[model samples]
Target chain A: MENNLKKVDIIFEDSDKCAPLKVLEKTLKRTADDIILDLIDSGLKGRGGAGFPTGLKWKFTRNETSDVKYVICNADEGEPGTFKDREILDRVPEKIFTGMAICGYVVGAKEGYIYLRGEYNFLLKGLLKKLSDFNAALKKLNVDFQIYFKSGSGAYVCGEESALFESMEGKRGEPRNKPPYPTVAGYNSKPTVINNVETLVYTTMICHMGPEKFKALGTSDSRGSKVFSVSGDTPIPGIYELELGMPLHDFVNEFGDGDTKAVQVGGASGHCVPRKKFNDTIIGFEGIPTGGSMMIFNSSRSMYNVLHDYLEFFAEESCGQCTPCRVGCQQLLKGIEAVKRGERPPAYLDDLKKLTGTMKIAAKCGLGQSVGNPFNSIIDNFREEIIY
Target chain B: MSTTEALVKELVEKNGRTRNSLMPVLQGIVQQEHFLSEEALICVAKELDLSAADVYGTASFYTFLDTVPRGKNIIRVCKTITCHMKGKDEVIKAISNALKIKVGETTHDNKFTLLSANCLGWCHKGPVMLINDEVFPELTPQKALEIVEEYAKK
Candidate 1:
């Protein structure tokens, strides 16, 4: 089974010669539309867990006729259980900058910003050194572009693109209303293309390797490789880059502890697949898509505790701008505690599920919309453990 | 002028007096003062031409920019699922016991403060804690307390 595993190291293929910068020079030779078309052919989706087509996002930003445009690399890796971006920023900071530069050239953006999370403030000095190196390289290549970094003040909601914009503008990191969308109006109301750190790195890869080779790695619906942050109960708990559409069972066979009971894909906002469903689950767009967090849980772990921890996180992390997300998170956390304490009947969970459903639809942004994912999944899968 | 007022003035001058420099200015204040004083917030608001409420709301919204004064050494223990599964509670308890204060409270000597953080992005090395800027991962209760003691002494 291990023999069939394919590992691609396009992002991590850094040499003394600076591979991504060389690729960016090659990519700059192509027309803007041609580069966007190459991305479309590659079929790469946003690695930010939303599965938005990368080419479509770029094309929209590229097509916007604006005097000012911005490219932002979302380095706010705040999602619990996800740490792949942190590694990328630490090891190959230049690759991310190169990717952002390429996006700027294609989208007609002259300025870019990387909104790095505050928890990673320690990485500021090293990343700044890399940025200066990248800027020097850009000057040498005669590219008229610049990159900047904004350190977030420890808000998880800032990971959202609009909130990131607000944070960068020196405001509370709250998400803005869509429809103008980031493509038409973003980052001081200019056309902005905000791509995830990993997504931009992958863009560099697609540009260097060509669409055909990148597409051939994963399934049709989900193309290219994904880097996963594996933790909990696994003998080897670290980052692993694998083909996008690999089955959950296969991943478990390779990384899970022998007594693995469930795997939480995509962090707290993601789903939990139990042992029985691992065979049917695939880690890609067609199955359970992830933002690169794969936390394995063994038999010794309590499902209720896992669910409780996630609820607590959501409750505290909710932006409190919307009532549904703010109140809904607290209620879900309290409701589960009530069930655990035998204060409420197990059937009362149905009402909480209905509340989560409301929060999913009624909340303004992704934070509120997706809280129901882990809430419903955990309640439905482990009713006995949660109630009894 | 008071130290708080002087610091605020310096930050405003360094980051510019525009409203768009609010967050960075606030972050700079917090970095220097460890917490944002009411005087500092008001001074920042006056310099940026914003209302005190605006400055307060923005300062309170973020987790790291504490409005209230905390201990000299802040220890943030990870409370996410990966750390929870890896017995993070024991580590939290260890720190709490060593400091003689619960989570969210400062010690009597004002030396250390213990708080639970959502995630420090060190899930792979579960059971992690961030002491100020440094990360200590894969911790046991003994190691966690020992580290706390080492900080408490300093």
Candidate 2:
């Protein structure tokens, strides 16, 4: 057996970079508007694949007039090869809870939900205990807040915001038609603001450091560092948190352990940058979202199987909603078979590419848009491996 | 919701009866046993004042917590992208040779059941062999004996 990646301390070196846990008790005095301003100034963006501005989502949700609003934490991270959220929830449980509490305050929501993924029983066990303790403290402090726990069906599709809302509402985890996103209308048709685990965790930091300091760390546009689950054929392949817009090549060598030929940023929905494009890419929203999953491929690795695995995940976890994703994912997986058999002509490849492009544009949500990424990346990068 | 007559009856037979009793019942019967027996799930549903579909839906959704009884020692072999590309077939061959069972089947002794999952979220550590969630990363045919010995000792 080969020695595996070691869990190291690359991210939290400046543990003092975070808001002190004691600050949560003081938050009861702050109003929702103040919290929103803090987040907006922080330039906080959604950490859950999309990288949409978190403060903008909150502003939209806050604009909706609903007394029965909700603040949902999309902790149901079913992204293939991603576990950065798991570590944050496991290690910094207080930050997530505090972030949720801040969301409850900012959005004027009476109720909050931490929709944890189903396989995370180990994680939930610890979180549940922390919630209990936090609740008792809150009750003593007379803070009017309540966050409930809802488990998911391990479907990667539920990672999408609207679909997660549907699951939280006790329905099948299928994507909802958008225009009125989670902000204007969400959970139970109520105005809801859904943020990623990291998004919420960072909220505490944003509030503490002030928005300008939070915005100063990463890039000119995107702000702050991101935690990524680095995987594949590498020497050290666990999670690493790096400043946004950090050079991809520097990252690959420093954290990726120098055995990478290609890299897939942003889990299943991410782009695969071949060695040729690796230097040109930066690890942020401007290029492609790292989305907590940074997967590397050594020269010895076969690209064909990687494409197949990602396509299969999309096929199974498409939430069977919106025909484009549900059917498109299946087509991509089956297309691999045709490519393997050399039955697909160059025209056939063009058709498949067109289909993926269609899914990216026309599909219901981020799940559909991101679903075609691996198919497009693999076909573009590794046609030789598919025939071999 | 709380437990019902069927639930209370089972609670007496197993755990206890009360409101908000699903988590404990799930812990007692499902997590410990690996899969909730039909009778156990029905009992849980009846106790929680919920439908069997609701119970089954809850049960099947999570990655952990199986619904049916599995073999004694669970062998979850990673068939994820990296593993597949790196000759997972060879690892599977070794697994099947050692256990004398194909993927998704249990041995005659019911001592081992092999599962082919997409990835254990550990693609970098390809061919991860988990004997009940204890990850054995970058596994090989030769390493099969280590698991064999561990199971034998157990």
Candidate 3:
């Protein structure tokens, strides 16, 4: 299984050979349907953890009739352990802009926006300069597409597409109801193609190397390699571009500090895979799909503290627009604390688990709904550690 | 015109006086002034044609869009799990001890305000802090103090 762990280089590949502008020009020669079909053939899902089919998302927005449409790059990389998007924005922003331009060409959008999180505001000045150059290049090519930057004030909920739209509209970053999804009514209440920054980069790569090349990498469900932000209890902690569908055991063996106890796949909202399940666990859509957050925990760390930290984070970051999320997060935090303080019996853990169940069903958005993933996995695997 | 009023008017002119311009307008004020004063909020509401409450509502929702008065420089130490794992507490303590201010406190001179923030997305290089827009990662307590001392002189 360790031998199967191969590092891939499609993401940070030198742009001299596969230049983004050249890829855009080559892609524009093809019809929009053809480009979308290539994306569909590539089987590239949204790299932002939701796993939505990227081609289908673009096709939906493209199909919608609208006077005004937008292509948005969701650069709000606020997932607790995820930092690949930041590296992407810092190193190769041209590729991201070009990807958005291609999306604009395909989706009939004249304007695009990158809703970057406020913490990464340091990158804004450099990004703006690069964007202006990209815009100039677009004008020279007679492409009527332009990209702009929108800074999100420190709100994690704004990472949600609809909440991002709300933030862009100068409102509170709250997730709107679905059905009128981003494709149908998004930023400024028009048809929009909103993609993760990494997802857009993959679209550009798919155009450069063709779908067959990308489709050859990972399993059918999760196609192409992904940029993983590896941190915590690891000897070499940093970003890695690895082929998907490898067993979790291989990842632990490669990145672990040798005394690894558990790995928190994805961010705080993602699942906690105990060491025993490493052989069975797959780091792809077929098993525990992550948005590229692989936080390895060694035996030295306490699962109790990790879970407590996560609950506290969720409690603070919840938008408070939905009661289920707002109150549920608070209660979970309290519930765990009470158990640890001996205010509640060990049996009380089961009741709190039920509360997370309610949160799973009742919470309005992914932030609240996914809290159960970490809560259940941690409590189920390390119940004694959480108790006393 | 008051500085706040002038700033608000200037931001509206730059970003456009629309409902969508509310965020950038507020962010502009915070960038310059460090926090949204009541006067700044009112000016923004008046310039953007909204109620003061409406403006404040949006501003207060974001952690970075500080409503209370902040110092000339804001020091946000990343307190998320990874940073916590990599000795953010020691870093925070060092900053607090050096500045004679705890987390969420402003210096008497209004030169610096120390606050612990959530993830700044530098997990690999943990124990990170942002002094305003500039991010400093992979800090020991000594390095954290040195960085703060350098900012204190400014």
Top DockQ: which candidate number? 3
Best by TM-score: 3
DockQ of 3: 0.95
lDDT of each: 0.89, 0.72, 0.94
Model 1 misplaced stretches (Cα beyond 4 Å):
A1-4, A16-18
Flag regions of model 2 displaced more than 4 Å: A1-19, A256-259, B1-29, B36-69, B72-75, B82-95, B109-112, B123-154
Taken in order, the candidates have interface RMSDs of 1.0, 4.3, 0.5
A147-210, model 3: which lDDT tens digit per residue? 9999999999999999999999999999999979999999999999999999999999899999
Better of 1 and 3 by TM-score: 3
- Tens-digit lDDT string for candidate 2 (A240-268): 77678766777676655466788888776
B92-150 per-residue lDDT for model 1 (tens digits): 99888767899999988778889999999999887999887778988999999888878
Model 1: pairs clashing at backbone N, Cα or C within 3 Å: none
Docking class of 2: acceptable
Model 2, residue A42: displacement in angstroms? Answer: 1.6
Looking at candidate 2 chain A, the ten consecutive residues that score lowest on lDDT are A1-10
> Model 1 over residues A259-341: C-alpha lDDT tens digits?
99989999999999999998888889999999999989999988998999899998999999999999999999999899889
